[model samples]
Target: MNNISSISNPIRAPRAAFLGSNLHHHHHRLTILPRRPNVVVCSSSVSTPTSPSLSVAQEANRIGSLSQVSGVLGCQWGDEGKGKLVDILAHHFDIVARCQNEREAVKLFHEIKGATPNHVTYTTLIDGYCTINDLEEALRLCKVMEAKGLYPGVVTYNSILRKLCEEGRIRDANKLLHEMSERKVVPDNGGANAGHTIYNAEGKKFALHLVPSGILNEDTLCVIGNGVVVHLPGLFEEIDGLESNGVSCEGRILVSDRAHLLFDFHQEVDGLREFELAKSFIGTTKRGIGPCYSSKVIRNGIRVGDLRHMDTFPQKLDVLLLDAASRFQGFNYGTEMLREEVEKYKRYAERLEPFIADTVHVMNDAILENKKILVEGGQATMLDIDFGTYPFVTSSSPSAGGICTGLGIAPRVVGDLIGVVKAYTTRVGSGPFPTEILGQGGDLLRFAGQEFGTTTGRPRRCGWLDIVALKYSCQINGFSSLNLTKLDVLSDLPEIRLGVSYKHINGTPIKSFPADLRLLEQLKASGISYEVLPGWKSDISSIRNYADLPLAARTYVERIEELCGVPVHYIGIGPGRDALIVK
Candidate 1:
């Protein structure tokens, strides 16, 4: 009777309860069988057959394994699915970490996804974590999160380490990185994925994109266009410098002249490109900025400093003038006449040096004193040099990197990058914009937004909002908040339309902006516009709060919030700064 109970009695079943009524085979079920001694059956109808020694070894391997797990970095530019990935991984990690880059991804995703799941919580994307100078606080946060039963992942660890390294805290970051790896949260060795190649008929071409150096949070990884190979870790450190570089407590509102120069200068060239891209739809202002920058890159530029040595500058200027004249040999620009203009610029360069200081020095000092400095960009992200529609865009980093290169301040000094967007979309220059609204719809938005250049007075080619483009801009700029401008312009519309995405030609859906102009045109031709929301009717200029706005206006703002995946923290009723509504 004892042997029967021990060997064959179904009453003494496996302690792990192999099967029950709740077990649904259709939903993937497991079965168990009895075995002698410590042997037991598992759900897969398979036995592990592991001995006690093997079990110990398996546990040890799991604890010690340095397996690679992907952390999302930006896919394209900045806002490439980073927020979504970070949010998803936040559940498994103690902290949602970042380096220098802001949480454009998280902010945008939160705006899109709306109310978070009960299990989810907010985490900071430390704007300049690499240079925050307070590794202790960041590490404490990680510890706090861990104390709550979460593990710190690469995003969190790398940012703190990057800042430490930037502050000449290399040893600290390395130690942290090593510790993170030991905990199974591997450090990202700053590297970019295989970037997209642009082929020309002339030869097999590849992009000359810039890649960053340093350790990166695993979350941002993508092959960008051009030759830009970004090491996110390095970028994080640069950003850390900006964040920690906090401005000095000063009374004056300082402006970065370099940025202003780039803005004023690039506008003309970019406008020309826009004019070319606009075809017959628009006019462009021919500012000599493009020629100037191109000349500078080719070592033929007349610098502002060259003015003090005017005698020598003009000789070099003549060579560039002659070269430019050759390129535009048969074009509208007169070669001989333009050479005289070069002399005129010499006088202008002489008068402008008093305005040029080591701008970075004063700006950095102000940052140290915690002064407020606004680094306003001239052109939109679509017109950026490396990331934007190439050959048709501006020759500068109008995105977040512009702050670094333009200001001479580290990434950590600049805080809270705000991205400005027009409610409906308009593109001034040429490229493949899938959301371009043509015919009457485009015409209406153009006229309503008064979509004309502030400096040039040229009309902008209008269309529905380009969410894809907007997202890209948000990512590259490290936008912490969004200023949704021109909401009042959409009031009179009976209905509104938005450009959601393109009907990709290759039978595959691409969420990103296309690099090939012809392919972009095809996408534009075949693209689909997703109209999910309607426009507002009320005059929103008077509305000062998010709740007081008209339902339609609120809905419209919310829709944009959802679309761009970045919250509209502030809305613009009109062009004036006073016309802001804070949500």
Candidate 2:
């Protein structure tokens, strides 16, 4: 346990290796951590659970971060007793202040939520990139800053030149020196050239006038969360691929800054856990989703913001990787392993920084501005954390109620719950599906619908639409409208089936969709009651309106609407963007 520190305060003091530059000093000593180094960051000493003093919305509004342009920025969003210090002094300053080094500067920068960057931010980042000898990225960022009309100040130019000279790249250094002289920008105390210092030169490229502006009303903003790893570019591409439906959401997406970052290590842990620990194979996506959420619940999760301010990432990641390494006996891992993860995560964090924002603020501000905001959930109600089948559920809450909990939007504003149900039911991985069509029928529907996990590519188990489960979901989620997908998958079949009720092996009908996993499994094993409908063999993919659907299709949907007690507002006929038929 030589390297073991308490789990409660596990930010290892920066070692001597980081001392010469910005990060080696001042790791705060807090309460004693676990001797075995628990990756979780909660107090082991406390016997009682403490209630939240403020809502997440309130806490988000209070915590803000101004981007560091020229100096060390703002705050660290964590424990270790440092936040209290910032909370007390943040209100006292009008101007963004400087710190001794880049660490404190970025801390200040990240403390404010919506603060924009200027010349100072550009300079600090440029210097940081130069420090790591990542001059290429630094130079690229510098070019971007200039393109955005923020001129690099003297310190900015000076730092790059100095680094070049140190590396003995005298030609590049001389080229920069020539540029500074030509642009009439002075070097610090004439260090680079003979006359006049650029230190006093005015940064006139950006405007500085402050004025009161009215609140801005924005369009509908969509947020995608839960059970899946982040794929930002793919997200926009998917949105673009989705038919506009007379309304487009191809604009600004406010991602939750609080969402956990899924790492490659998580995926490794998931596959290994199922293989070695589980009594039976519970098919998982092995996307690291479960492990990531486990870390989140234990309060050791790394967020999207951690990606932007990566100075303390190693400290946090060290605990995570170390915990994982020690937990699994079959895995090969250590300091070198941890170091590799750190570099990999650093790149991920950098790539993810631009999209990170306080979604709580965005939600609140959107309401204040009277904007239409839509929070998109990833999974269905059957996978909900509280109501869904336990030990067989997704790691996150995916029901309508999860929108408020996950997005930090207050409950009062949550309205208009919409449920999306496939015409034929399908599920990936191991879960007790009561109405599953196990033979050739299941295979046909699975192929027709392309029922497979997008990321894992695992074939999904297909079945009839489960009305027993649908009614239960409706009871819990309170759907105002339904978006029925893959209606076309049911086409050309001689008959369509809907699971209406479940009966036990003893010939007694069950009251409702069973929450008990054992009973659910038994219910699936015993077979459930279904109402059959005649299938329409005609292709309806080209149908644009619900009324134009075949009589059989209309009857099938109408029966679902009748039974589930909700309007099917939108129906999917095919896989294409324009394949939907709106009611």
The prediction achieving the highest TM-score against the true structure is: 2
Residue-pair clashes per candidate, as listed? Answer: 64, 29
Instruction: For residues 1-583, write the lDDT of model 1, one tens digit per residue.
Output: 0011111111123321111111111111111112111122222222222222223323222212211211223212221112222222222221121222121110111121122211012123221222224456556656666666655544446557666767787787778777877888766543222111122223322221111111122221211111111222332333343235441112211222322222122333433443333322222333334544555567655443454566675576556545644554323344465556556656555544443344456655655664333333334566666787665565555566655654465766555555667777765433454566655666567767765433222234666666777777776766666767667888887555555555565556676766765566565545454553444566777655444565556656656666677766546675442355544
Q: How far does residue 381 in candidate 2 sit from its true spot (Å)?
A: 1.3
Model 1 superposed RMSD (Cα):
26.7
Error of 1 at 384 (Å): 1.4
Clashes of 2: 29
